[model samples]
Target: MRTSFSQYIRFQKRLLILYAAIMVFISIMLYVEPTMSIHFSNLLYIHAVALIFLMAYLTIDYYTIAKHHKELSSRWSNGMFIQDGIGAAKTYEQQLYLEMLQSVNDAHQQQLTSILQDKKESMEFMTTWFHDIKTPIAISRLILEQAKENPDNESILEEISRIERSVNQALYFTRTDHFARDYFISRTELDTIVKSVVKQFAKEFIRRKIKVDLHIQPVVVETDSKWIVYSLSEFVSNALKYSNDGGTITFISEEDSGEVRLSIKDEGIGIPQQDIRRVFQLGFTGTNGRVNRKSTGMGLYIAKKILDKVGHRVTISSKEKLYTIVTVHFRKGDDYYSIVK
Candidate 1:
């Protein structure tokens, strides 16, 4: 209880002492001057009795209010529920306070419900649109596969591939926010994820004349595979983008300090020192990005987002004209992902 019985005594003890002082003064008068002793003694006795009744009434009233306050405080401390109010109150003021609290709680619940419904609808629409658009994309890719061998169709196929990658980026970006709803976490092979992304960019690798080197050990890590694959693909695409024809891009994975680290190294025009910190910012196109007109400024941003969500770390180290290396580190447990891509 916030207001204890001792606290009440501390407040009213002075008044009690004053009453006693007055009674003692009357008794002294009766003793020093016995002519009016009967009258003074009887008056003192009646005052003492009245004082006792008044003290008792004040003590009971203070304790009752204090007990109620303590109960209400304890209940409110448990949670901010309007229903957990001063139930069965002995006073009208407490009942009014409870009614005010209930009104606020009701409004809060309604606002929360509306926000949730809006978010649900938005997620559904994004998912549906992503899937629906993929149907035509798949059909187009099939048609391109037949005509892709023709030299005249080479550049067209490349542009179409770029389009497909952009669409995939958007779809994955949408999914990243709701990772819990769509992804499964388990022991995923690091080499396997890397190989799949490499294969997806095989044509680009050939066209760019970029030499590929893979030094990945068969490391097992707890992660969401699909998202990891997309992240690696983004890294590989970036490597292909800035590298000179016949330049080397390498993938290395190792266990370091009880964590799994994967590095993608490219002999590409590197990120300017000033832009290094801002590369991960959404829609940020650095000096290298501006030179490479193909940079959407979203690849590294999405990659970093995905890595961070799954309990991974991404760091980029580079020299002006030499090379760029993007490293991702992951721990060995499942983590629920959030806010990425």
Candidate 2:
């Protein structure tokens, strides 16, 4: 209300000055007219009546002129947009402003839509390319397997596996945004998924001479089996990457109070305390990455994203140079299918 009054006062200040000036001229004329019969008391009475009438006119004009200003002020204070709850424009300038704002909004929306469409097309192409490239990678691996067992063949096979992992990572990264369309939720066996992931990395295990201590019970979870397998493979790959020759990687599962926890603990060069907090951040190669020199830093980040979308929780705990344990928690009663829907 105070703001509206101030606007009203500013809008009419020029007219108010003109009115005061006319009244002053009238008073001067009445004073200087010696031949006139008007007395000083009569002049004072006339001036008082004129002042009352002027105040009445100002009150009506204030309400008439400041009505729109008051409405706009109320909307702004309440955190509403200019187009919200504001009725038809009372002036040409206001109408022009509204039309201009609407045009700009429309243009912005079109530009944003174009950008998203381009990104979707790019991801679709990349996903197709990844799939196409995997055919040749598989052929290469098969050809290498058929050859004699030698150190060179083994190294070539390892490099091929590395390429395959990289391609799969890129494919999954693209699919992350389109997860709603790609994933299906069902009652999946947790142990089966873990074994499959381990099988996928069996060569890596053998090459590193790392022992797998699987203690998983026959636990089941409601999640997308494909995504869960990929996520677990990422963790297992990380374990194999950092584990020393003849070291142990333990996989344990336990259920308590309707919650199931699956842990992958590795005896490796553990994460530094300062780097642990940022390990899951995208493209953040921490102290361990510096030591290994092969970390793309997307494995844990992608795993966490997939787990969260599946309504599962993942936590990591580590002691420097001792052990790093990554745990995935699943609640038996959660409606994970709702997330897919």
Candidate 3:
């Protein structure tokens, strides 16, 4: 049990009262002067001086205790306390205090463990749900493919494709936290990764009539091909999403100073300055998001996470209504890119 300030005050007050009673008794004895000698009078004066010093010490001690009461309570709760004086708590009280502190620490540890277990279970469930949902999405896409000959059916197919992309994005995002252990890094051709990612958005590029300027060389880099492809696709998709129809989108990759730089530049409505800092933050769809309500805000966030794991860096530079450039920097000897290079 914790001791209160009032209880401590009462204890100090008792000490003061006992000291005062002893002084009063000494004064009465002195007044009686029943055949006392000069030596005895000197001894009484010495005793009074000592009592005054004791009272001064007690006053300072009380003030210090009052000032630090709250701090002492917190320390006690956390299994730390200061004990002084010969008549302090005995062995039994000390043991009880230690036991109480250990119990509190054990409870705190159990609570943290329980929270972590719940989070692990939740992530596992999401991963399983995403995998299960992909089957129906595939079936719908197949049905749409077979019926694509009709113009009215084309819209349904487009919508289905969009839904498929969303589901895949969600699956990838959910799985990225575990991607580090599963990733395979090797030397991959820069052009090959670019071509694969571009192919996925071939239909969107065609539909928007966006001009593509590809300046990629047959350069090689060490990196995770799958994550690199996904990262590049996210940038291109963002470019396509923000750019007006007929706007130009440029995909450029080159090796410079032992580093590979790949950039996606779009002549579109660029991002605002305030939104640029928060673009890669999860669930942050900024000014562009307000205009394009279809943006899920997870694309850049996922890309950033995946790239960082693989030792690649992604950056964005934008001028509102003028242009936006998303750049991915690749260093040499990264497990994924090094094998490919």
Ranking by TM-score: 2, 3, 1
- The 10-residue segment with the lowest total lDDT in model 2: 81-90
Itemize residue pairs with steric clashes in candidate 2: none
Q: Candidate 3: lDDT of 332?
A: 69
Candidate 1 residue lDDT tens string, 1-341? 48877777777787778877977786677667857656655776877787789778878878887887777787778874355445675768777876777788889989999999998899789879878887887787778788756776767777778888888899888877777677666787888888898899888888878788999998897788888899989988888888889889999988966789999999888889999999899999888777767777898898888888777889999998899999988865544443222
Clashes of each: 0, 0, 14
TM agreement with the true structure for every prediction: 0.69, 0.80, 0.72
Tens-place lDDT digits, model 2, residues 1-341: 55566776777788889988998999889889887778889999988999899889888767755776777778879977554656677668779987887788779879999999999888879989999999999999999899866659989988999999999988998888878988888888888888898899788788878899999899788778899899988998888888789999999999998899999999998889999889899999998798779798899999888888888889999998899999998878877557552
lDDT of 3 by residue, 79-101 (tens): 65533111232347556875676
Predict model 3's lDDT versus the native. Answer: 0.80
User: Candidate 1 — which residues are off by over 4 angstroms?
Assistant: 1-101, 148-150, 287-297, 332-341
- Name the lDDT of candidate 2: 0.86
Q: In candidate 2, residue 251 scores what lDDT?
A: 95
**Model 2, position 56: C-alpha lDDT score:** 90
Question: Number of the top candidate by TM-score?
Answer: 2
